[model samples]
Target: MVLTADSYRVLRGWVNGLGYSLDARLIPYLELAGFGSATLTQTFDLQYDLISALVERWRPETHTFHLPCGECTITLEDVALHFGLPIDGDVITGVSVIAEPAVLCYSLLGASPDDTDSTFSKLKFTWLKANFQHLSVNATEEESVCPARVYIMHIIRGVLMPNLNNNKVHLQYLPLLADLHNVRSYSWGSAVLAMLYHELCRTTKPDAVDLGGCLVLLQLWALYRIPFLASVSHQPYVFLLVNRWSIYPGIGRLYTVLIYRLMIEQHTEEGFIWMSYRRPEIAAIIPSSSYVDSQLWCTNAPIISFNIVEWYHGDRVLQQFGYIQYIPDLPMPVGDVHGINKRGKHGQHWRVTHQIFVAVWENRMA
Candidate 1:
């Protein structure tokens, strides 16, 4: 079962794609394993057997990697280490190599509070900084367009929020945001803003000063330039679905339907949009004729009413009363629950309820 030259080429391509060197070192391993003179099928079988043996010996499945904030997951970091690849540079950042167990404990649990000089913690911090720095910005003159700003805000609020820490990282990026604003690099500025929001949301016990700072920053951004909802793009809608947060509840559900029509039904080709969850339930609520409604759900009271009455009422009651046991039916046009008003056609009720449902479903899936 001699291996074909074509099979060798395919293996070479795979190794190169993984950022591994292909040289005499690989040749010896291949020949020693009988891959140098085997059929394509035989070569695959031999490689599978070798990988299985390595997996058994290494027990990578048993090793759990810890994140900076106490999250743990099984990862291939052990396998990467066993393969003698560099674990700290572009390799780790690009591939998202799991953190070593010790580093995770120190970063998340504060195992050694006084030891600020630990190598693993330093490495993790450096990796974080580098990854954010590497995010590409669209530096065109139209980068500050309304659609673009909304897109950037969605990315900040939804995608990057969970993994960031607000207290430490938000203030660190003030200068960068200021510089980007000065240069009119709205895309870059938006990225920094998103990072700040991400950190802000992660704050476990936010104090008055923290809330004030966040408010002030947000006000400044709002006043810097007015962002309109003109020229709706797919990115913001996709981010909204993926992050499951909407500026307005009606608007979010409207966007969900819009995304289904444009991306799923019409088959409009785009990146990022493909990765988002398709909310058919939302789409079902929207009338088919209103598929191209330029005003979105602003004037669609019936649909908006359907959204509130059908979906959000029960959750709103539970949130107020802590359980569904001692609650009255939600009054027409929802009322205030903890400063978030649910009444009115365009009130916070829609927004909050929609967010609650999205978060609940997302967490359940997770």
Candidate 2:
């Protein structure tokens, strides 16, 4: 559906309500990225990029099943089981409700008994189909796009904290979301936004905030099938702060450099900045010798090597340092240790190992 004037107004209102400024340069970047004009599509595209970046892809291991007729696929059933839940029904069936994976996602996270077929829900279904259609499995193919895991920590830090200004809401979801292994297959962004509406909007002043408006914008983006890019072409720093850095230590260093760059650009005084793992305790449980040449204190505590970068004003040099944190005892098996242990048969005695890097700056004022 085309973005009407009314829809644009609602979308704009939500963006403003969320305390996120539509970066002035975003429109030009969208045009450069070949997204047509500065229309609803572009707006939706930006939101999509932010949401996609925040959520981790669900890449589940699949096994092929050969049937008498043909080949069938075995996929996770968690999403289907959770879709449009609490509304009595064996299976989801309705004119509006389709069996598409994305539709199921919207239903699980966005749909409710009262507003099952809301405007936003319909729009989100269309967008999900359009955006991910390329990854859809063919009747003959055994491969399928697995459901994604919601990075609850990212959502709280990136989206809700900036707007809600309350940690209580974030605290409530922390326990449920922290247990990554058991999280449901649904849209994290939609779930959090829905909770925001229920917790703050419904019970308190309705007009106090535009939480509903924000949800509508998210739904519209999903409906329009827009592409999301987390970073602007000129701003690589945007990429570092938002995207996952666990895989790239170099990118992590670059992120540290970017923070310095911003400080240098502004000619600000020396100050301290740092980044750490979302769950350091998880690292504590795993054996350290299983992965790399890292120092280990004991089997109980995992030593995490943290890459540190330092910089000084007026000098384009970055001093590098290494810092380590001994995470206390939290015993937990990390799969078959043989695969991770590099010491061969003797490696069986070793524990699973993991490392994290943190960027820090210290400024002394005289």
Task: Say which candidate scores most in TM-score.
Answer: 2
- Write the residue-wise lDDT of candidate 2 on 244-352 in tens digits: 6536544443343343334323321222111111126533643332222111101111111111011111111011012333332332222332112122332121112
Candidate 1 — which pairs collide? Answer: 1-39, 2-38, 3-38, 166-199, 334-343, 342-349
What is the model-wide C-alpha lDDT for candidate 1? 0.23
Task: Tell me the tens digit of each residue's lDDT in model 1 across 234-323.
Answer: 246545563463554344433333433333222222221211112365345433332222221111011111122111122222211223
- Worst 10-residue lDDT window, candidate 2: 302-311
| lDDT (Cα atoms) of all candidates against the true structure | 0.23, 0.24
Instruction: State the displacement of the C-alpha of residue 8, model 1, in Å, after optimal TM-score superposition.
Output: 76
Q: Model 2: clashing residue pairs? A: 49-228, 123-223, 127-222, 287-351, 287-352, 287-353, 288-353
TM-score of each: 0.16, 0.20
